[model samples]
Target: MLSEASNFWGLFKSGSKEREFRKAVEQIIGEKPSNPLLYQLAFRHTSASKETNIGGFRESNERLEYLGDSVLGMIVAEYLFKKYPFKDEGFLTEIRSRIVNRESLNQVARKIGLEKLIQFDGQRIAHNRTSMYGDAMEALIGAIYLDKGFRFTRSFILKKLIANYFDLDAVIQTNTNYKSILLSWAQQEGKKIVFEIVQENGKHHHKEFVAQVKVNGEAISTGGGWNKKKAEQEAARRACESLEIKSTQ
Candidate 1:
């Protein structure tokens, strides 16, 4: 029952579950769904997927996900532009990114009760399925656009999704970009900030890097990751914690 059309529609002769799904869709979008197939595909994860023609595999809503990502970004950008007409580009960009980021979208999807609707492989990927939720959220946006057109999609996004899920004030007050926060604070306080790669190893596809963050030439903290940037970010995060730097980006 992993988002197959038949499974969704023909699950019960009574159509009780079908009615529930219909109600759920209406609740989520504030309108009746015109195209059920698109909604089905939006909830279909790659793990329990059907093969496509041309010898290709699209087990997930990845294509739709990509489309949704673009659509969501554009809508958010427009909202930000109109809402904060006087704010600078950096502030708008950061806030827009925060709204459309994976974690935020995942939370939004969960808030809208997409977890029960989304179909995925049972056990595998469940441990770290936050990205899956986020991806499905984007795919739903793509579905809305395709089924209802841009204007309706925009209304759903701005009036329903963003208005209900996204918190503008919290995002403006909080700073999740640890590296940027650390760098900016260091510059303000006249502290010399430097990042150095302490170690690098592993094969081409699975290389690992260890990085250290230094403040005033003293080792603040060290962290490791699959790439230098990731390692540096982790190191910066550790440094922020160690130095008690208030994350106000």
Candidate 2:
């Protein structure tokens, strides 16, 4: 299931495929899903979207991911607020961002065996499949919220995700903002650094951008992402790696 597969036959169909997928989801989430369609859509990447019979609407996880992003953010914020009663907003926000950032979520999704269930077009998005797993993780949270309720979803996130996958002390001590680090290094070294979008691919909602970093008019590194900012950060990350610039932030 890690590899890309074709689209689901229909939104309402409950065939063997759905059953298999349901079992897989149960193993990952440790709960039986009430509605299979939502969970199915949770792992469905945009490249693997299917056109519905009505209105020619393509069904993907984008909408679910949007909902899950907000839900996850709120849940994390609430948890951080309660756990660190004396901490300021800035500290909580930073912790939440570190926990929910693309690379962090991507690593968590892989650890939770989400890669086996995600369905994407490997051929179509071969080179730019950076954050699809993390996106799917958010979409899965949305599905869990809809399938269960807020209370159950909150518990699931707190117990199943944050408690299991993250160590708050380690997360607090780490800073992976490559762009900020690169900028700081450039400022200290008095070197001019620029990030340029070299290429853009895919549709409007599912666009992939390639960013190149140039220091003193010489291209240093290039990287890709689902958006421009991510792309730039990726490029900067590579530049940092190449230059052996350790993060000071």
Candidate 3:
């Protein structure tokens, strides 16, 4: 453990940076942070830095992101369970998935200024990977869990993150399942729809996928993502925007 003097000096040395971080946190979380290390790890991206200068095995925020993902899901589930006691399991699960999905999380993170605050190596790569901000948000949640315990983390997620950021009623009324939406519309219109993986590129550790959404044997739109499912989802979302207006279905 670091001595009090050492900790004080450490804070003194990092006073400027800490002030910046504190301001950012206040904007995001609506309060000053008691532990800043967790927030640091939350913004640290693997693409930007691999191994930390510290002696431990941690290289990036991947582990923290993993932990945060599970924790956030559980909290969302519990919140949904309590809020929608009469709703069935399927309804709760589907709504929870929408609330915690990559695109939705990324949107929330970007809206909360995390995209500007996130640390990464290159601008191009960082901008290209849309999920980076979302991943950082999850990792930050993990950090919050470790530093502030479950009660604080839960409040932050439900009250600050979900309540303030997301529109659950809008989400419930509108289906974000692009694939299902496309399929149902095509079926109603008596048209054929297909999603094909046209390309897969990137390093072994990180893969990029390009998916094309074809409607009635014509490629309507294309989108790329870190995974095929996400790519397909994007493609379908694009297809909906393009074809939806044209078809009454």
Name the best candidate (by lDDT).
Answer: 2
Segments in model 1 whose C-alpha atoms lie over 4 Å from true places: 1-16, 127-129, 186-235
- Estimated TM-score for each candidate: 0.77, 0.80, 0.77
Ranking by lDDT: 2, 1, 3
lDDT of 2 by residue, 88-130 (tens): 9888898898998888889899899887777777556652456
Model number with the top TM-score: 2
Pairs that collide in candidate 1 are 46-59
**Over 4 Å off in model 3, which ranges?**
1-14, 52-58, 183-195, 202-207, 213-222, 238-249
Clashing pairs in 2: none
Which parts of model 2 have CA positions greater than 4 angstroms off? 1-17, 184-194, 201-208, 214-221, 241-244
Give residue 162's error in model 2 in angstroms.
0.9
Instruction: Give the Cα error of residue 48 in candidate 1, in Å.
Output: 2.3
Cα TM-score of candidate 2:
0.80
lDDT of each: 0.81, 0.85, 0.79
State residue 229's C-alpha deviation in candidate 2, in Å: 2.9
Per-residue alpha-carbon lDDT of candidate 3 for residues 23-124, written as tens digits (9 for 90 to 100):
777777766778876787677677555554688554777888999999999999999999999999988998899899988889888888876666655533
